[model samples]
Target: MVGRLDGKVAMITGAASGIGLGTVELFVAEGAKVVAADIQDEKGAMLEKRFPGKVVYAHCDVTKEADIEAAVKKAKTEFGGLDILFNNAGISDRMSTITEITAEGWSWIFDILVRGPALGMKHTAPLML
Candidate 1:
C-alpha cells in the first residue's frame, strides 16, 4: 500500500524541535519530501542528517518576510514544488499578568507568534497552490 503523502512535498516552519519536528518525521515516514525551516541552525542540521535525502533544513527567522521567502524558495528549488505548508512557528511569553508583560515582551511575542506565521503564509500560500 502507498502512503498518503507519497511523492508530495511539504514545508514546515519551526521544524527544528517540538511539534514541528514530529510533523517533519511523520511526513517523511509517509514518503513526503520535506523542507524543515527554523532559526536553530545546529538542530536543523542534525535533523537533516537524521533524515538524509528525504529532508532539507532552512535557517529561517520567521519574523522576517525575507527569511520566510527564502525558505519557500529553498523548498521549491530542492523539492521542485510544495504541496503542504505547516505554519507552526511561534513563541510564548507566559506573562503572569498584564502589568508583567512589558511592551518589548509583547512585541517580541507578537513578532514570533503572529507576524511570523502570517509572513510564512503570505509567502508560501501561492507556492502551495
Candidate 2:
C-alpha cells in the first residue's frame, strides 16, 4: 500500500537528535522526504548519511533568522516543495529551577522555544502553501 505521507516534503528543526530525529525517521518511513535542521553538525551529518537521499541535514541554529531561512530554502531545493514543518527546536534550563536559572539562560530558552518557531512559520509560510 502507499504510505500516508507519500510524496510529501517535511522540514523539521532540532532534527539532529531526540524527538526531532525520531520525526525525520517516521516521516521518511511514511514516504516523505525530510529536511533535518539542527546545530549539531556531527549528528546532523550522521542523520543525512543514515537515510541517504531521503534525508537532508541543514545546520540550523533556530535562534538565527538566517539559519531558519536557509533551512527552508534547502528543503525547497532538495525536494522542490514543502508540505509540512515541525518546529521542534527548543531549549530550557532543565538542570536548575526556574527561579534559579540565569538571565542569559532565560533569554536562550525564550529565543529557541518561542522566537524560533515564530520566525520559522514566517519564513517558511510561502513554501508550505
Candidate 3:
C-alpha cells in the first residue's frame, strides 16, 4: 500500500520516548524517513533497531545550536533533504509551587522549550526552503 508520507523525511526532537517516540513510529509507518534526535542514547539506539533504515538516531540536546545543526545535517545527508521539523524537546518543572521554581529551573525550561525550537527552526528552515 502507498503510504501518505512516502519519500518524505522528518526530523523529530525528543524522539527517544513519550510523544516523540510515538511520532517516530507513526511517521515511519506512514513511509517517512525520520531523524530521531534526543539525548537518550540507549532508547535512540532502540528506535534505530526497531525501524531499521527508515530511522536514524541523532544524539541531540536541543538547547545547543550545534546539536540541532548536526541533526539537520544528518537528515540532509541521510535522506537528501528535510520535509518536516518537529521541535518537540521540552521539560516540565516538578516544582509544586511557582515560588518553588529556582532560577536554574527556569533557565532549563526556557532553554529546552524556547531556545530549542528556535534553534531547530534556524537550522531546519534553510533545508525546508
* Cα-based lDDT for every prediction: 0.88, 0.90, 0.92
Clashing pairs in 1: none
Off by over 4 Å in 1: 93-97
Tell me how candidate 2 scores on lDDT.
Answer: 0.90
How many clashes does each candidate structure show, in the order listed? Answer: 0, 0, 0
Better of 1 and 2 by TM-score: 2
Winning candidate number (lDDT): 3
For candidate 3, which ten residues in a row score worst on lDDT? 90-99
Q: Model 1: per-residue lDDT, tens digit, 41-105?
A: 99999988999988999989987888988989998899897888898887654644777878888
Flag the better candidate by lDDT, 1 or 3: 3
Stretches of model 2 off by over 4 angstroms after superposition:
92-95
Q: What shift in Å separates residue 2 of candidate 3 from its native position after superposition?
A: 1.3
Candidate 2 weakest lDDT stretch, 10 residues:
90-99
Give lDDT tens digits, candidate 3, residues 52-122: 99999999999888999899999999999999999888775454467787899888888988989999998
Q: Candidate 2 on 35-92: residue-level lDDT in tens?
A: 9999999999998899999999999999999999999999889999899999998764
